[model samples]
Target: MRVLLTGATGFVGRGLLERMSALVNLELIAAVRKPVSGFPENVTSHVIAGLEADTDWRKVLDGVEVVIHSAARVHVMHEQTSDPLAEFRKVNVDGTLSLARQAAAAGVRRFVFISSIKVNGEGTPVNVPYLADAQPAPADPYGISKIEAEKGLRALAAETGMEVVIIRPVLVYGPGVKANFLNMMRWLHKGVPLPFGAIHNRRSLVALDNLVDLIVTCIDHPAAANQTFLVSDGEDLSTTELLRRMGVALGKPARLLPVPSRLLEVGATILGKKALSQRLCGSLQVDISKTRELLNWTPPLSVDEALRKTAKHFLEQQSK
Candidate 1:
């Protein structure tokens, strides 16, 4: 099979490229914004700048069987654009639909889109996880754009007889993870006193390896066509348990203070960090039973094993 992967330099895309390149039966082509080095000899790199709605994909779409579309205007902490929604739509919704149209016309068999669990909503009721068929209730502009893009892809699939597989993953983490997951690891490594010991909210997360494996399966799996699936590690963790496990992986003490969840929320609100507090104390779980039942897939790596790899990489990078 011949596959074209976008965002080849990104965290998930890079991992996918490395793993897929090693397969003897597959030929890989990387669609990047600019020239990149260090890819395996078996992989070919093609440059297509901007990746916007007007960008032409005819040059690279020929003979491409599967296209894993991972490039997007990702979520930002502090959005600088005046119209954040418009900016996200320009790339995520418009650009994605444009590529799918051209890929369908070019005879591409399957297009796998990497979406976020945010499309299901920010948080879920306790023990009531978000399902793949739930009505989308996006809370942010990025999530809104992803849902819109998914809708467009489904419509295009119906019109063109092309297959569309959408995978919505929750909080992917691994060796090259950054942002909030990295910050938590840093805090645990430094032995900072955290007030999350009493929080019992559950959150689901996916390992990069596991997500990549699922992506590869969807690339050719007959049951995956025109389906929306939620991807996770099949294990949910509370904030306190997650910190404890990460601390063990990092070979450090968690040093957690048993502060009441309500007190912490009130303090955070007083300090104008309510959003941060909510992320730490809220529940956001996803149900992947549908994905497993449909594709007979399970995450290959356990949470502890994945975290150990993540911590080892973090320590190595810190030493450098």
Candidate 2:
């Protein structure tokens, strides 16, 4: 079977590529916006000018049965413009539609779209779990684009009869990872005392390996068509517990001070650290029951295993 993956140079994409190295039945095609120098011998890279650019996408789409749309304007720091949503929509919404159309025309069997839990909602309250069927109430510009893309993809599936599987992953963590988690890890290594111990928030997190496994399953799972799945590590961890474990894995004493959460939140609000506080002290747990019940899939990695592997990667990087 032939498959194509966009954003193949990214952290999550790279993990998926590495994991698929043992799949002898798969012919993998990786797409990046610019030319790449090194990749696995089993995969070929195609540089794209734009999703609907003049270049012949058919060449890459040839005989490809699945398209994993991993490329997107990823949610990161700082608002770029007054109209950030418009910019995000161009790449996330418009670009996705273009690729789906081409894949449909090429008779691709399935299109697996990677979305974020942000598309569902940002923070969870108490013991409630975010369901796949939840109405999207994206909180940021990046999430708005993903939600728009989801709507477009569903329409494409209806129009072209191509199966579309959407996987909404929550706070993916693993080796070679970046963003907020990485920053926290760096701070932990530096032995900083974080006030997050006060937060009783439980958040769902997905390991890179677990997410990659789900992506591959979506490619062939018969029931995945026109369905959306919310994924995690199949267990949730409180901020204090998560940091303590990470500290354990790093072989460092976890420096957590049990400061009053209300006082901390007030200070963060005054000092323009609200976003950071939200991330460190918020809850967003998901129920993977739908995924488990339907595909009979269980999260194969333990949280400790995931955290340990991630810490090892960071240590290796520092040594380099």
Candidate 3:
């Protein structure tokens, strides 16, 4: 089947690209923001025009059987000015709708949307793991846009008689992982003391490979149409336990300083930090039973193995 993928230059998209490139008899249309270097011969690149306007998605959707949308505006820091929601709406909501409409017009078989767990909430408690049926309560503009996109896609599916599959992954980590997790790994590699030892928060995380596999299965799975699934590593870990395992994966000792949670919260507030402590110290757990029961899929790698692979990638990068 011919597939068109948006955000093919992103973190998860890159892995999807590598996997798709090795497959025979399948064509990949990669829509990217910039001109990428060293793209494979099998893949076709399309630069995204203005996201807000209704561009010609019909051209790219031609002969495309499936679409894996991995492009999004994900950021912790509000670097953009003059309304963040407008920025998020333009790309995540508007662009997604335009693409879906054209994909439907071209009779694409399936649309697989990769959304974040933040669409449920910023954090979850120990007893209540967020499920696919949970009411979406996005905590930030980025997440709000994702929720809107999901809603829009579902409505479009109803109107156009197209198949829609939504998979929400939590904290996906792997090789070439950028942003917060990468920084944390760097700090751990340097043996920096972290105050997360005292926090007993359980966060659900997904390995990149596992997430990619789920997406692949969702592309044409009979059970995935009009279904939303929460995908995770299955193995949940507390803050301290995660740090300890990360240290083990890195082959280094974790320097955890037991600071009071209140003190850390105060410090974070004084420094104008927004949601750092909550993200690090608070819990965001998910239930993946629906995903497992439907697809009979389990994460092939454990958290330690995943962390080790990520560390190895960084080490290899350091050597060069």
Candidate 4:
């Protein structure tokens, strides 16, 4: 099978490229914004300036069987654009649909889109997980754009004969992880006392390898065609538990204080950090029962095992 992967250097995409490149029966092509190195010798590279609605994909679509799209205008802490929704739509919705349409016309078999769990909602009630078919309640512009893109992809799949597999994954973490996950690791390594020991909120997180494995399965799985699946490590964790486990993996102690969740929320609101507090103290669980039953899939790596790998990588990077 010949596969074309976008966002080849991104966290998820890079992992996919590395894994898929090792398969003897598969040929890999990477679509990147600029020239990058260190890819396997057998892999091919195609440079496209940006993911705009008008970006030309005619040349790269030739002889491609599957396209795993991981590229997007990812959410940021402070967006500089005046119109965030429009900016997101240009790439997330419009650009995605444009690529799918062109792929369908070019006889591509499957297109796997990596979406976010934010499409369902920012957070769920304690124990009330969001299902794959849950009513969408996007809280921010990025979430809105993702839901819109999913709808457009579904319509396109109905119109064309191409199969579309959508996987909305929760927070993905592994080696090379950045942002909040990485920061948590740093704080834990430094023995900084965190006030999250009392946070009992359950949040689902997927390992990078697990998510990549699902994408590979969707490429040829008949049951996955035109299906929306939620992906996660079967186990859910509280913020306190997560930090403690991460500290253990790093061979350090997690110095967490038992602060009241309500107090934290109140302080955060006063400091204009309510959103950050919600992420730490809120629940965002996803139900992957459908994915397991339909595709007969299970995450290959355990949470503890994956965390150890991530910690090892972080330490290695720190040494260099």
- CA shift at 154, candidate 4, in angstroms? 0.9
Residue 190 C-alpha lDDT in model 4: 86
List clashing residue pairs in candidate 1. Answer: none
Model 4, residue 64: what's the lDDT? 96
TM-score of 4: 0.99
Off by over 4 Å in 1: none
Off by over 4 Å in 4: none
Q: In terms of TM-score, which candidate is strongest?
A: 4
Worst 10 residues of 3 by lDDT: 49-58
Better by lDDT, candidate 2 or 1: 1
**Which prediction has more favorable TM-score, 2 or 3?**
2
TM-score for each predicted model, relative to the true structure: 0.98, 0.96, 0.96, 0.99
* Model 1 lDDT per residue over 1-320, tens place: 88999999999999999899999889899999989999999999999897799999998988999999998999788889899999999999999999999999999999999998989999987799999999999998999999999999999999999999999999999998999999999999898999888999999999999999999999999999999999999999989999999999999979999999899999999999987887888889999999999999989999999999999999999999
lDDT of 1: 0.94
lDDT digits (tens) for residues 1-320 of candidate 2: 99899889888889888877568899999988898876889988888876532345788899999999898888657775788888898889888888888889999989999999989988989689899998888998889999999999999999999999999999888998887788889989999988877778888999998999898888899988889999999888888899999999988868999987777778999999997777677788899999988888888888999999999999999889
- TM-score comparison, 1 vs 4, better candidate: 4
